[model samples]
Target: MIVLLLGILVLAIGGCVCVVWADRGGPRWVRAVAAVTLAAGELLRIARRNRRRSIKRSSGGDE
Candidate 1:
């Protein structure tokens, strides 16, 4: 389990590096990886926001 978490952390860091490198005119593969990482991050952000909204509604927080 620990190994899996460490692997994920490494991948996340690598993806971030790719994003920065792409911004600085890196190779095609780096740009592609950065794009994917950015899109995935956006999707996750949206999903989390929607989940929070749903939870708030269920708890009657609109009052």
Candidate 2:
């Protein structure tokens, strides 16, 4: 959840940069979508990893 939110916020900042330097509003969409997808994937991965770690710890597997 936190990771997803952070990723979205980061992607939004990157999108702002893309638009600001879009040259003529041409390459704004593809890059933005690509960036958003990447961030979303990363966010999911991070959340999954954290969930696994917590599960392991709670199960006394941390030893």
Candidate 3:
């Protein structure tokens, strides 16, 4: 689990780097990686938010 988390963190960082690189006209590949990374991050964020919402709902909607 720890390894998996670390891998995700690495990917997130790589994605951020790619975004910056692409913005500075790095290359087509960098832009592609940036797109994928940003999309994955967005998906993960949505999933996490939904999970938290479900947990809150299950626990009588308490804060």
Cα-based lDDT at residue 52, candidate 2: 92
Per-residue lDDT of model 3, residues 1-63, tens digit only: 999999989987888999999889988999999888888889999999999999999999968
User: What C-alpha lDDT, on a 0 to 100 scale, does residue 3 get in candidate 2?
Assistant: 100
For model 2, residues 1-63, the per-residue Cα lDDT tens digits are 999999979977776666555545547585666566667768989999999999999999856
Per-candidate alpha-carbon RMSD to the true structure: 1.1, 8.5, 2.3
Which residue pairs in candidate 3 collide? none
My TM-score estimates for the predictions, one after another, are: 0.94, 0.54, 0.77
Tens-digit lDDT string for candidate 1 (1-63): 999999999999999999999999999999999999999899999999999999999999785
Error of 3 at 2 (Å): 7.0
Stronger candidate by lDDT (1 vs 2): 1
Model 2 CA deviation exceeding 4 Å by range: 1-26
- The count of backbone overlaps in candidate 2 is 0
Query: What does the lDDT come to for candidate 2?
Result: 0.74
Q: Candidate 1, TM-score vs. the true structure?
A: 0.94
Largest lDDT belongs to which candidate? 1
Model 3 residue 40 CA deviation (Å) reads: 0.6
